[model samples]
Target: MTTDQPVRAAVAAPGGPRPPQDGPDRGRGGPDRPERDGPPAEGPPAEEARRGFLAKAFGVTALLSAAGSVLGLLRDLLLARYFGANQGTDAFLVAWTVPETAAPLLIEDAMAFLLVPAFSLALVLREERPTGPDPVRQLVRATLPWLMLVLAACSVIAVVGAPHLVRLLAPGLADPQLAVTCTRITAFTILPFGVAGYLTSALRAHHRYTAPAAIYVAYNLGILALLLTCHAVWGVRSAALGVAFGSLLMAGVLVVPFVRGLRATRRPRRPCGPAGDSLVLIPLAILPVAAFTLTRQAQVFVERYLGSGLPPGAISHLNYAAKVSQLAMTAAILIVLVTFPVVARALAAGDLTAARDRVEKDLGQATALVLMGTAFLMACAPSVVALLFERGAFGPHDTAVTAAVIRVYGLGLPAQALIGVMVRPYFSIRPVVRRADDPAATGRTTLLDWYPVGAMALGLLVTVAVGVAATPRLGALGLAAGNAAGITAAAALLMRGLLLRGIALRLPRVLGGQARLLAAGVGAAALGVPAAAVTADPLLSTLLGGTAVILAFAALGTALGAPEVRGPVLGLLRALCPPSPPAAEGKLPHGR
Candidate 1:
């Protein structure tokens, strides 16, 4: 079957061979009804459509992020001016870390990882046969009770354990009074994350991915406003309150639309069985999911531990530097966030081939997108930090520390991109076709929705452990190493799970391409580094050096067949040029 084929047979040929299958027409009125091909049904055209969707997704997210970045820059500038990366910022950083970690744990993992993919799968399953009661509605209806329960439980746990968590994370918070105040504030607001998480998940499931994704920009803006408006009035406590208010505001926005959707879909066209009657079964899986997200939070806990040991402003310096890494190419991450559920649904329907294709396309695009961003950030790290935060309590020393961390974290950009892609298999919907060694099951395939939550949980633990060990030894640089190792290990294990389950990796082919991309990266870095070393002005030097490096990287990678390296470069060039009349022969017909 070609990539254009929409309906794939779950059944396998003898000895795990693929059975001959035709296109969508062949599967009409069958158990697996094919979805409408948005445009042409051919592979190349289909790939092009997928690219278009990704571009639009990227564009929307980028615009929103750019706005948020500008606002954050201003906010940080004000904080730097007033607070100047001192004890106040340190207190704020330690306080915020608890909730900030929630971005990945509660928002990214709880909502995006589990809920969105599960929701998307339901839609895909029902889309193949829309006449029946919508599986989408059934899933949503069943999901709510569990979401609420989890929210309440998380709130109680956070409130009860806040002080202990503070002590564990920031041992330096020896002042009983200060520690108690920060912990109380942080715990009071933790419930908002639980509420916001479910609401965001609901929106994602409804295909309103953009709004909730963008809601974060507002969340950040609120924080920015709080810092600027209240810092002078209420001091650090006000800053903590700002975060609390921001999270609550985010929760409010997330819930309003979600509730509307809930009311609209109150009754399903087709009722589900008792298993789907409550969210209990679905949320049973959240333990693994929560574990997966918590491991990410553990890294922040580690940072706070090591951070408290540093000088007064050290935690704030590390925090700012981490944000540079986190927010850089954030729009691209959002694009991935939007696309993941769509891909998950395809994977869950026993469509391994389709899943593989979607993974490659999105992974390839994301790799290119992030690589360009890495190049830009690496070249201009000092300048970027200086321009954004230097005016505030941010001084030369703080800038120096932050820039150093950013440069080190920059080294792990590609690895993080790869990790993002590798994690997808954990949520894959591959069919357990007749195992290669099993013969009686020929032409039979069982859809296996393996939510490798266990692997994810293990991976998170590995990541946190590695990060903690590395950070203490290497300083900020060690943190980056830990991140790479943990994520790489997690990704490796996820892929291995597929292999262990009998899916072929075609290692030689994959490695061959990766080698080419790596070579290009190295070659670019080789020249860029030397140029940067000799240049007088760091920012200007970076601009000149980075351009040379990217040109070299793109040329070499393209020549050597790195699809990840070539596709987006061409897309970017196309985006730059104005639309022109169709050419006759080689020359432009007009307006060239």
Candidate 2:
């Protein structure tokens, strides 16, 4: 018997080991796969093993995630120190759009959206029919080959058309040839990125977190090593080469684990005729998601395009600002990231209540984290930028402009996090149809909805319109304002769409909670601004401003009855200094 057989059997039903799949598909017996009508073969040992992993999963993932974010920030610092923000960095950044857009499409947004639900659905099917062909393996086998071919071809096209791509991205670039070279080099990231994304989706569905969570750490390390070692020789092109190398490391780290898991299926069952056709969701649903991702990323295109028409350093300044601002959105979304698979599983088991509850709680937690970040980041923008990038080639002027741009961009953190969290529900609780082979089978089929893409397109149009009207006046800050406005608009539209889709979110509660948080945010910002203004030193300003923001937000949030903020503060107080037995039942005379 293979090692995975027992675990697989137990996970065949809802509330079983490995975090449960569903009950409807459980009691299938076969020589290759066992029938698990009760507890897992190893029982409590199995329970303990899975429980231990879940307990440590979030903490471990958070630690690795922090390392990755810190390393990524360091990577940017090295770039500013070594290359500085100039026409050269702008040229590289125009090329940098390749990986920036590709990373989300391949690694985070599109691939995850398409594959996670597909994998979850496959696992459910596998539970239902033990004697049928292994659906998970079947899924990988069916899609991986075609995906490799398409991504490889796309990479080649990118290399051959680098000049045209650069021209389209930034028509008024000072150094078009430099951009072409970087584009050609970074284009190779497409293939490795696709592989890495696919592997991550499969692994996460199976409850393996370490390798996937550590991917960005590997990614950033690769970029830093190569850029540092080769910058003297290759100049800005080293950063482009670093992008390609880093993507390879991302794919490489996940391969061994993926292959090991796939091999655990052992022997495959004989033909289940036409069963493979049932897994059509992967091929069909990818379009709307991919379209959604591409349009969302087109925000970068708009920024660079507008910035291109301005001065030499405009694009570079915008890039630095965007990267720094997104850190808040990134940190806040990690909470949603870990919970997405659980929501998908819940939906797969036909448990909408559990999925809704999970989604609601996620919204609360995500809003709180992002709001706190937005407060601190906005209040301390100048100091934060000065402390991180003021030295090296990035002078006080660069710091000043970038700081302004980042604060303006910070206006969109709430909306961005909203989109990130809300999109999970759309992809998870898909509408299903009956399978061809089994008349009674309840399975999801691919249905493409263009509403998401349409919403993004509208948002992009607004961004461009606002950017044009303001670029001649406010410069990069205007562009940042346009972005914030556009995303806020998009976030509203998506919520409307979300309600129309019939996902019973308590709109009044959600909106009311957000209003309270916004009130707290205003108070935080009001106090935090002057706290920083009191000190000229960047480090001092950052510390004082950050502390003031946190304190004001908590105090105000508690007063306003915002659960996200109050819950955490009260919990910490309880942990540090518990209440002393009701003050000894009216005998609290010592202090009095």
Highest TM-score model number: 2
Model 1 CA lDDT for position 223: 75
Clash totals for all candidate models: 8, 1
Tell me each candidate's RMSD, in Å, in order. 8.7, 7.1
Can you write out model 1's per-residue Cα lDDT over 1-592, one digit (the tens) per residue?
4322222112111112233344654323211112232222247755665455555555665676677676666656666777787776676666676677666766766456666666655554444444435455556555566556766676677667767776777777534355556656766566677677767765655545555656666777777777777777777776677677777777877766776655654332443323221121222334455565666456567667766766577667777877777665565576566666556655555566665665665555666666656665665677667756777467877777788778777666665676566555554333211112223223322232333445545655665676667766666656655555555555556666655654455666665666777677666666666655566565666677767777877887778788877776678878998579665787765775
Taken over the whole model, the C-alpha lDDT of each candidate is 0.60, 0.79
Worst 10 residues of 1 by lDDT: 8-17
User: Residue 377's C-alpha lDDT in candidate 2?
Assistant: 88
Which TM-score value belongs to model 2?
0.87
- Point out where model 1 deviates above 4 Å: 1-50, 128-133, 174-176, 256-283, 329-331, 428-474, 501-505, 530-542, 570-592
lDDT of model 1 at position 296: 45
Clashing pairs in 1: 80-392, 80-393, 81-392, 81-393, 84-393, 133-270, 347-429, 348-429
